[model samples]
Structure formats: structure tokens, C-alpha cells
Target: MLNVNFYEHIDDTLLKFAVIVSKSNGKWVFCKHRERTTYECPGGHRELEEDIITTAKRELYEETGATTYTLEEVCVYSVSDGINESFGMLFYADITEFGQLPESEIERIELFDQLPDKLTYQDIHPILINKINSFLKVKGILNNIELKDNIIPDISDLIDLYNDVGWSNYTKNIDMLKLAYDNSLRIVSLWDVNKLIGIIRVVGDGYSIIYIQDLIILTEYQKQGLGSMLMNYVLNAYKDVYQKVLLTENQTSTVKFYESCGFVSNDKYNCVAFVQFKM
Candidate 1:
């Protein structure tokens, strides 16, 4: 089985290619190669000294004849099977116009709301499309995401969100958690229609510092940039504060995720953080 991993960032030294998952109106866009009957997203390998964004744009135009569109970065992704690891950037595009298809390896372009069965990389295409949709929802690319400040969500949803992420300790102390939420300096909750999907709460003076206490998305809703979205909302809301901080378990992936949001390791800045535990 191919191993696929998603990242917030990675160096060029490990990247192998880029993929652009595009949509026009509200339908998905895919390309067919001249020698292949199966469909695939518009993508290709990087050229010498070419930036990855340019690679995605070039491949999208060459494959689908996209003439007018806006693109957004989704995330970095990697795949491997114990032999060699391959890295790529994931991108999403909203195409508004198309020109005549170029005379290239592409045979044709197709748009769909429901994907066709015959895809070039059958094992990978579907997963990539899902990731793209998640990107859309999280980044508000094709969906309306409502943000509520100081709005309290349903207790059940909050419990589910915390429990889904293995933070049952918070769930077990739901009363205390609710009290804390009620007193937070600010609360940012993200919603899809009426569903409580993501949330971030900040505490501290509105001017001096803002400490993020809880930032969560339901387990089934992770990896689509929802976490980053929540972080961005709080960071921007308190951009002028001298101290913006959070403390979480020291795991590699978790640390990387936070770092992507303009945060640095305390050690990197020659500062130290101390935490005390009560037994």
C-alpha cells in the first residue's frame, strides 16, 4: 500500500512534484492523457529552478486550457512505500474561463460532480480529491464558513470535538470547561451552516497578551486546514498583542503544525517555558 502523509510545509530538497485540483463553477476538473484512457488532475514534475506554484499553474494550463482562475495553496503531501519518499504541493483552483486546449500530451478535459470510475491513479486520485474538498471547506474556497466571536456552541458539539481528539480529560470535566469558556477573553467558533465544527478560545488582556487555550476540530474534520483556519482567526484578531501563545504536547507533527502559523520554538529564541504538574 502506498503511504501518504500530509504536511503544513517542507523544504524543496524533498519535493518531487505538484498537483492542482481544480473546479469550475462547482464541478471538478480532470485531465486525460493522450496515451491513457484514465483521468487525472492537472499536475506535473517541477522544472529546473522553477517555483512549485509556477509548476502547478503551468501544468493546469497545459492540461486543461484554463485561462482565468484564482489559485490557493492547500498543503504539502508526501507518499512512499518504504523504498523512496515523494513530496508534492497540493493546490486548489477556481477556474472561470478556458481557452482552446493546447496540443500537448493531454487528450481532453472533463468536469464532474461525481467522479468517473476510470482514473489514472485510481488509488490516489479519490483521496486527493477529498483532500481538495476539505481544503475548500476549510479555506472557504467553495463553501460559506461562518465565524462567531464569543458565541457558545452546543455543549454536545463541544464535548464531541474534544473527545474526538482524545482530550477526554476536558470532556470529563465538562462543567469546568464550560465555565472556562464562559470567561474566556474571546472565543472564535467556526460553523458549517449550523454544525459546530471548529473552535478556538483565547484568554488574557485584550492588549498585552492573548493565550490560546483551546483550538479543536472534530477528528473526522481534521487535515483540511480547519486547525490552521482557527489559528489564523485568533492570531489576526490579536495581531498587535505582545504575547500570543499556546502550550501543547511536544510531538513532532503538532510542533510543525504550530510552526506553520508564524510561531517559533521557545528554544529557537533562547527563551524557556516551564510547566508544573500536580500529583
Candidate 2:
């Protein structure tokens, strides 16, 4: 059985190739080699220390003769065939034209409405297809969630979103809220067009320790995975930090959500958080 492991960031030196899976007009485009009857996604080994992204485009063109297209990154993945782990970046493309078929090792190209029975990498094709579909669905939704980093938002809009999410205790002191944002190590705000819908703020030295100071999504936007999107954005940005921390009210739903994002209770490390209330 082949095992795959995913990470937020890996040493690029360990990367092997860029695998591009393309679709055109709702049909999948696959490559056929002169020596094989089985079809495969258009991909090739990295050459002469080229960037993985460049390798993706070059391989797609060389194998499928694709000229006009739009490509989007899907993810970075590593597959272990029970011995060695091979790392590669996965990409999605929408090919519009073949232009002219180039002379290469590829024999021909084919389009299919459904996956063909003969695939070069049988165990991997289904996994890549599922990932592509999931990526398309999530990208469709997140396309509207615009994220801005290190930006000073309009205070009025900030207050309004804070109030809309019932964080009125903080919004009540607008200056304090503004000051907190100003002092944050990093801030990522999510907007729907001109409307502010979500905000995530971080504090502490960005290298050694980072704390999620605040993460709020307007009540109307809650439960739509926007929160997860914001959290993921933050995690990806600060993935190298040694200590990532957050404190939230101990609600079952809240705990479950954070746990799903790889967060664990401090109790698991024999630690506890304490706060003092002034009377």
C-alpha cells in the first residue's frame, strides 16, 4: 500500500517534480506515452534545478502540447511506496487549446468524461482525482473570502464586525480595540467585497512563539467554514513557529473545531491557562 504524508512546507531541495492534472471543458485531459497503453497526468521530473512551478508548466506543454491555459496550485504532497518518500507539488489546470502537438516522448493525448480503466499510477490516480474535486469545491467557496494581511482596516468597519459577532465587550472600547489591532504581530482580515466578515489577529515574536490573539467571524458567516479558512491561513503563514497558541472559551463546539485544526488542550502537556477578573 502507498502512504502519503502532507506538510505545510518542506525543504524545496527534497522536491522531485510538479504533477499537473488538467481539465478542458468539463473533460479530463490525460497523456499517453509511445511505449505504454495506460494514460497518465502530464508531469515530468524537475530539470537542472528548475522551480517546481516552472517544471509543472514545462511538463504540461511538453506532454500534452497545451498552450492556452490557466493553472492553479492544489497542494504539496509526498508519497511513500513503503521505502522512500517522494515529494511533489500538485497543480490543476484548465487547458483551452493544444495549438500544435510537439515532438516528445508522448504519443498522443486523450479526453475522457470519466477515468479510464488503464491508468499509469492506479493507486495514485483516484487519490489525485478526489483531491482535485475537493479543491475545486473549496476554491469555489473561498473565492469570495478575500484575505488581507498586515492591513490597517477602517475602524468603523472593524467595530461593526466586532459588534455583529457579539464581541461588543471589545467593541465598546473602540480605541482599545484599535490599539490591539495596531499592536498585533500580524493581522489577516477576510472581506466579502467591501463588507468585513472575518478577522484573525496574532501576537508574540513571530519566530519562537505565536499566539492567536483573536479570530472572529460575523454570526451570519459562522458555520460556513470561514473560520477554518481563516485559521488555515494563519497556520500556513506561521507554520515554522515553534509554539503556536490560542485561548478560547471552553465550549464543546469550539473545542472540537480547534481540535480538528491540530490544536490540543494545554492539559495534555500538564499546563493550564489562568486569568484574573477585577471586581
Candidate 3:
């Protein structure tokens, strides 16, 4: 039996290989070895004196001819076959450009909307792919959901979303909700064709700090990872800003969700938050 485990970090010396799960044009990238019909993610054993990141880059380029791409470390993973264990660093890559495939064991490259059934490391690869997807905070390809930036959604749609989520306070005064959205520094909305399903509102000067004023997903879409996708979009947009802030009710689930997105309580930084709501 094979067992797999994931970690946020591990000692560098224990990492013997680098495995990169990559995508090109939003499709999953996999390579077929010259000797094997099964497909695998582009990766290989770490070379002597080479850091794991360099191994990942070299393997990706050699296996897929991916010349231009962005790579991010996902986590450290270990696979054990009951008795022996091996460790590797997992990475996620977004490939934009490719060159001629280098002379290597990889026979060809393929792209698929989902993982292929025949995988080189059947037991190991699926676990690694699932880990990468979870690390990315994406449940799956969000079919038919279009993300619109800075578009103030129609008041009726907004009202429906708020009401569905039990935030009746916002729907009670439609005019004020519209006005608030209009004044937001940035607004990202998720539209299922004509229906508004989720939104994230930001308010800040765009330089020193940005506050997540509101982030909501329609009740039906709450657990599908649409909320995390919206939050990630805004986080990447303001990544250069010094501070990203938000306030929320101190509920267990809500706190865990935000913490998973890399937020910490003010007390952690020896600070406090103050808030005053209209009576």
C-alpha cells in the first residue's frame, strides 16, 4: 500500500526530487516518457548540488519545453510504500511559452482539462495533483462563471445575493448598497451568465493599504471555492500594497476560512481592531 502526506515545509536535505504540476493555457500539462505509455507531470530527481527549485525548472523545461512560465512552490510531500519513504518538493507552474523539446526521456507532451487515467506514478501522482489543486484553493474549473472587475452589478442581483446569504441588512436599503458599491475602490463580481453569484469589494487608496470591505458568495455557491477564488483575485491585484485588511465576525468557520487564506488576528501582531457600526 502507498501512503502520502503533505507539509508546509521540510528540511531541504530530505528533498530528493522535485515534482511540478503545471498548466498551459488553463489545461493540465503532462508528459509521456519515451519508454512508458503512462503520462506524468514534468519533474525528475535533483541533480548533484542543485537546489530543488533549479531541479524543478530544469525538469519542466526539459520535459515540456516550457520556456516561459511562473513557478510557485506548493508544499513538501512524502510517499511511503509501507516500509520505505521518499520526499519531494511539489511546485505549481503556469506555462505561457514553449520551445523545441530537449533531447530527453519524455516522448511527447499533452494537455487535458483533467488528469489522464493512465499515469506514470499512478498512486503518487493523483495525490500530488490533488494537493496542488487544494493549495491553489480551486475546487475545479469554474464552468460558465465569468469574473468581472470593477463592474457594479445590478441592484436587484446584488439584493438577491445578499438576501440569499441572510444579510438582510444590506437588502433593506437598496439605494445605500448601490451607493456603497459605486464608491468602492475596486469590485470583483462573479457572474453565472446573467446572474450575480459572488462579489468582493475593496476600499483603499491602492498604495499603502487595502481593506476588504465585503466579500460574499450566493448561498448556493458558498462551498464551491468561488469565495476563495474571488479573494485570491483581489489579493493578487493588490499584492504590492503594504497592508491588506478585513474585519469579520469572530466565528469559528469564518476565522478558519480567512486563516487558510493567510490572514492572522490583530492580536498576533500586538495590535487591536476597532469598529463602530451604525445603530
Candidate 4:
């Protein structure tokens, strides 16, 4: 219910920028500058006549003293801190090439703050942000566009839809989607404004337990923390009605994802599933 575009409302033009995060021993390399006392990712404004990637690289070199490595845009954030009109894009860089820390204009450096910074997407929760996420195939949180609902642009045609395509093979194609879309089921789709980016299907009797099936989100959209958003919606919407929302995920990279979404694994034996396919 807060203003997300706090800067744009007054500035008329939103500011553009970039940031870089360098992971090191035990703590990440961060810098503090200007009036901001909190340590932030290393990067700054995009100079006129500049592109995004280049801005990220220049910022990286200036802050961390790491001149060589690969960088990727992890997430973009609105830099409307309080009344500030500046916007920033947070980049996650894998520093394959390591070097010494350079002397940056910013002096203070801190490591691992327990709480998310002022730069987080939810730092300034724009009213009805959920409506915006529900309508796009790919929506930028930084864009702040609102929407109602959009399953997919051409959902009927896409064959290997889920990032985990192998999972879909276990079930029929139409059945898979149908389960996700079943209004009778409390299944829901996650959209980035109007296009569907991922979906979560809830199955089970409403009383005893509800199983969370298939929280499939695209690889490109994974790190944005949409999974957590989906789970929050489910939990808050049905916390009183449902006693437990259980899910079974494979023991791979997915296990951690589930854990972060408020699932706890047990050391108790006899915890496994059997799917006897009728071959």
C-alpha cells in the first residue's frame, strides 16, 4: 500500500543505474558512499550515451578492483530511497578472475547485513503490486506495471514449458496444465504483470492437508524470488483454513528452494514417494 514509484511521481523521469556484487571469503564486497551509511552493492549511475552491461562492468572495476570476470544481471531495483529519484539494477557477478580491491570513491565497506537493504523490491511496497505481477510473461519489478491475469501468451502451443521439462513427461500434457488451471483446485499462476512466468498447484482436501505441486518458474525468472511470493500468497490466503501445505521435491537444487519457502525436511526414515506408472 506504499508508493513504489516515489521518485517517478515527482521527477517526471525515472533515474537509470546499475550495481555489482562481488562475493569473497566469508563476506561479499560492498561499498558505502554519498549519504547512505548502509553498505550497498558496488555500482552507480549509467553515464549518458551508455548501455547497461558496460555500466555494470565499469562499476565492478571501480569498486572491487576486480578487472576480469563474468557478470550477470540478477535483479533490477527501483532506487527511490525515500525521495531520491535514482534507480539501480543489481548485478550478480561471478568473479572467475580475481584481483585486489581498488581504491573507490566510496570508503566504508560492510559485510552481510541480516536484513534486506533499502534497495530491495519490497522495500517500498507499491500498493497493489500483486495485480501487476499477475499479468505478464516477463515483467520487471523495476517497471512497476500493474496487471490482472495472464496465463501465457501462447500457452497452448509451448511443448516443453516447465524449466524442469522431465517432470511434465510423468504426466499427460493437457492434464498437467489442466491441473494447474483447475478452478476447483486452489492452483495459481504467477505472472510478471500479464504474462505467466511460473505456476504453483495446490492439491489435497481443504481440511487435513494441502499438497503443493509443481512450483515451476522459468530459469531466467528464478532468482527474482517469485517462488517465495507465490508461497506467501498461498499461506496468507489459507493459513487459518489449512493445517499443513506439504510438498515433495527431488533432492537436487530444488530442495533448497522448497526449504526457503518455509518447508522443513525431516531426518525420519520412511519419507519417500512411489509413482508406479502403468507401463
Candidate 5:
């Protein structure tokens, strides 16, 4: 029997290969070798003195003719066949353009919405695909849910979302709420079909600092991991900013949630936070 295991990180030396699960214009990219009839994701063994990432890029370009693309490390994976084991780094790529196929073992490339039944490595490909799907879902890129940037939702939908979460201050003044959204540096809203389900609003100079003005999720979706998804989206968008800040109620659950998202308390920095509100 064959077994596969995944890890967030491992010794770089252990990664002897690199496999890229790629997509172009929302279609899966798979390649067929000149010597085989089955298809597989583009990948190959790491070469002498070549980093795993370099191997992935070389293989992708050679096999699929992917000239323009974005690649991200997904995780490390190992395959064991009772007596021997091998390790590889998994990557996800979004290809934008393709040039002429490089002269290589790959005979042709195909795009599909789903994987073909005849795959080159049946024991390994399915497990790797599942890992990629999970990674995309966590990064808020997959699933039926849609995330919109700076899109102000309908007033009724906004009100319903805030009211469901017991946050009446925003719902009480629809005009002010809309103005707040309009003036913010960025607003990321999450939707389930047409229903507005969650939002993360930011106020900042867009360079040195960004404050999380508000993050709200409809009550029904509270424990569904959508909040972290929204938080991760904003955090990644502002990763280059020097400072990321937020203020929240002094509650245990809320503190824990933010902590899990990589936020540190002011007290840890030996600093205090103050806010003034007009009565």
C-alpha cells in the first residue's frame, strides 16, 4: 500500500522534487508525456544545485509552456511505499499566458474543470489535489462563497447582517455606515450568493499603517471559519505595511481569535491604546 503525508514545513534538503497544481482562467492545467497516454500535473525531480522553487518553475514552463504565472508554496508532502519514501514540495500556480511548448518529454497540454480519469500517478495525484483544494478553501479562493473588494453592499443586506450580529450602532444610522465604508482605505465583503455574510473594513494611509475598523460576520456563519478567512485576506493584502492594528472588546474569546490570526496585544509592547468618542 502507498501512503502520503503532508506538512507545513520541513527540511529543504528533504525535498527532492517539486509538483505544481496549476490553473489557467479557472481551468485545471494538466500535461501528457510523449511516452504515456495518461495526464499529470507538471513536475519533476530537483536538479543539482537547483532550489525546489526553481525546479517547479522550470518544469511548469517546460511541460505546459507557462510563460506568465504566479506561484505559491502550498506545503511539503511525502510518499511512502512500505520500504522507501520520497519527499516533495507542493506548489499552486495561476498561469496567465503560455508560449510555444518547449521541446521536452511533454507531448501536449490540456485544460479541464476536473481531473481526467487516466492520470499518470494514480496513487499520488488524487491526494495532492485534495491538499490543494483544502489550501485554496482556507485562503478564501475556492468554494461557492465570493469575496468582493470595496463593494458596498445593499443597505437592507448590511442592516440585516449587523442586526443579526447584535451590532445596532452601525445599523441604526444607515447613512453614516455607508459613508464609513466609502471613506475607508479598503473594504472586503464576503457573500454567499446574493446575501452579504461578512465584512472587514480598514482605515489607513495604505503605506505605514492600517487599522481594522470593523470585522463583522452574520451570526449564522460565526463558527464556520469564514471570519479567519476574511482576516487572512486582509492581512495578506497588507503584509507589506509597517504596522497593522485593531481594537476590540476586552473579551477572552475575541482576544483568542485575534491572537490565532497573529495579532499581538498592546500590553505586550508596553504600550496602551486610547479612544475618544463624542457623547
Candidate 6:
């Protein structure tokens, strides 16, 4: 994504940014700081090994400690920080609930639904405001996103899904072993009225980090964007809520697929053994 022509006007450009936008207290909420103004979203630096949304979540909590909120991905834009820092991705999030701003946020924080009158122009950049506004207008997704409480069914058709779909290749194996052992594994199943369509198994300490052991989807259920959903459900159910979701797979397609679901490579980390041989 680098072009000499683009950097000609800026020097030593480094850093990408994302913003979290929310509506709480019956009003629109934007974070204000020495960082940026013009009613910007809440987000900060991209860390060494962190994914974008994770960075956003960490930043929001560190700055505000307001854990109760719904997050949505709006868009990403690149820009210069006006210093040596440049080329940032700004993401928008909507916070439906508001909590008291921590003391650390007082001097650096200002929240507003509408543009402040005669607001100090220093922290907020004009171009950044323009970018946020443009995105908000086009996407126009306010009030459409509602809180969802996932409803889980008792008898899922997920088993039949594998038998009918190609992903059944692995899921069928899983079904055969279902009654054999519990083995401290948490097998979350998703199904419809007729059959089992998707499945994933997670095993770990059940506290710090959980490893995704198996993920199977009926081939017929593929390409409908369910893989990401299943991964995300597992992640939130374990990783985000618990701080770590780790899985190892040899397939390039699997890696790419999970990456899109917010998995990143840890060079310091590698598979000890996808399979352990009987000694």
C-alpha cells in the first residue's frame, strides 16, 4: 500500500489509527482529546501484534474503562498525524451505553452528539472530520443495528449438516466420537430446523486462553459467510470475553479465512504438533 507519490508531502510517516463512535446517554458520543477533535471516534495506535478491532477495544477500555457498549465496524481511512506519524486507519464504533469517564479522561476527554460551538480546533483535524462525516452519511446504518441475544437451540441439526455437506468430512468424524469421550472439550453446535449445519470445538484452560480444535461446516453451508460468524461466536464466547482465542491449522486457506475473522500470525508462536504420534 506504499506509493512514493503519496508520501512525497509527508516525512517519516508512521502509525495507523481507528476511531470508536457510539450513541449513549440518549445522545451521540464521540471522544475528544489532544489526539483528534471534530467529534471523532475512540481508538488509538496499532500495536506490534494486535489486530485492528482488538486495538480499538483495548484503547477504549484503557481510556474510558466503560466496558458496556456495542461495537460495530464502520470504515477504515488512511491519513497523516501531521507529525512524523502518518497513514492511519480510522474506524467508527457506536457505543449505545455510557459510563462515567475515568479521571484520566477529564482533561483529554469531551463527548458530544453534535458539533460543539466554537470548539477548539487544535486537537481535531479538518480532513479527519471530513472522512468520518462522509462515512457516516453513506453507510447510514444508525438505529438499524439492534442488540442481539443469541438464541441457542437444544437439539441442533448440525449433525445432519455434515452428512449432507462436504465439511461433513471432519464433522462426521466428530459425530462418531461424540459418545466416546467428554475429554473436557466444549463442542458448540449450530443447527437449523432440519439438520446440523456447523460445528467447532474449543479446548484449553477455560480461563486465560482457549484453542479452537475443530471447525466444520457443511460444504453446502459454505460461502454464506458462516465460517467467520462461527469463528467470531467462538472468539467472543471465549477469546474476547476471556482475552485469548488460539488455533493452529496447516491449510493456507484456513489461515487466510481465520485472519479475516481477526486472527493474526504470531512469529514467536508455532504449532508444537498438530498431531502427536503414539510413542
What are the TM-scores, per candidate, against the unseen true structure? 0.77, 0.61, 0.52, 0.44, 0.52, 0.37
Where does candidate 2 stray beyond 4 Å? 146-210, 213-279
Model 5, range 1-279, lDDT digits (tens) per residue?
A: 789876544567878999999999999999999999999999999999999999999999999999999999887788899898788999999999999999999999999999899998999999998888877765663356799998878778888988888888887788998888779999899987787889999999989999998899886555446778789999999999998999899874577578768888989999998989653
Runs in model 4 lying further than 4 Å from the true structure: 1-160, 163-166, 170-172, 241-245, 266-279
lDDT of 6: 0.52
Pick the winner on lDDT between candidates 2 and 3.
Answer: 3
> Global lDDT of each model?
0.85, 0.84, 0.87, 0.54, 0.87, 0.52
Give candidate 2's total backbone clashes.
0
Q: What are the per-residue Cα lDDT tens digits for candidate 3 across 66-141?
A: 9999998876678888899888988999999999999988999999999999997888898888777766653243
Q: Candidate 3 — which residues are off by over 4 angstroms?
A: 1-141
Model 1 has an lDDT value of: 0.85
Clashing pairs in 5: none
The TM-score measured for candidate 5 stands at: 0.52
Name the candidate that leads on TM-score.
1
lDDT tens digits by residue: candidate 2, 211-261: 997898887555456777889999999899999998888874577578768
Off by over 4 Å in 6: 1-159, 163-176, 179-181, 240-249, 266-274, 277-279
Q: State residue 60's C-alpha deviation in candidate 2, in Å.
A: 0.5
Badly placed stretches (over 4 Å) of model 5 are 141-279
Per-residue CA lDDT of candidate 4, range 144-206, in tens? 422223233344423344534456553466665654555434655655555556666666676
- Badly placed stretches (over 4 Å) of model 1 are 8-16, 22-39, 48-51, 68-72, 93-98, 107-122, 133-144, 206-208
Q: Lowest summed-lDDT stretch of 10 residues in model 6?
A: 3-12
Model 2: lDDT of residue 92 = 93
Worst 10 residues of 2 by lDDT: 3-12
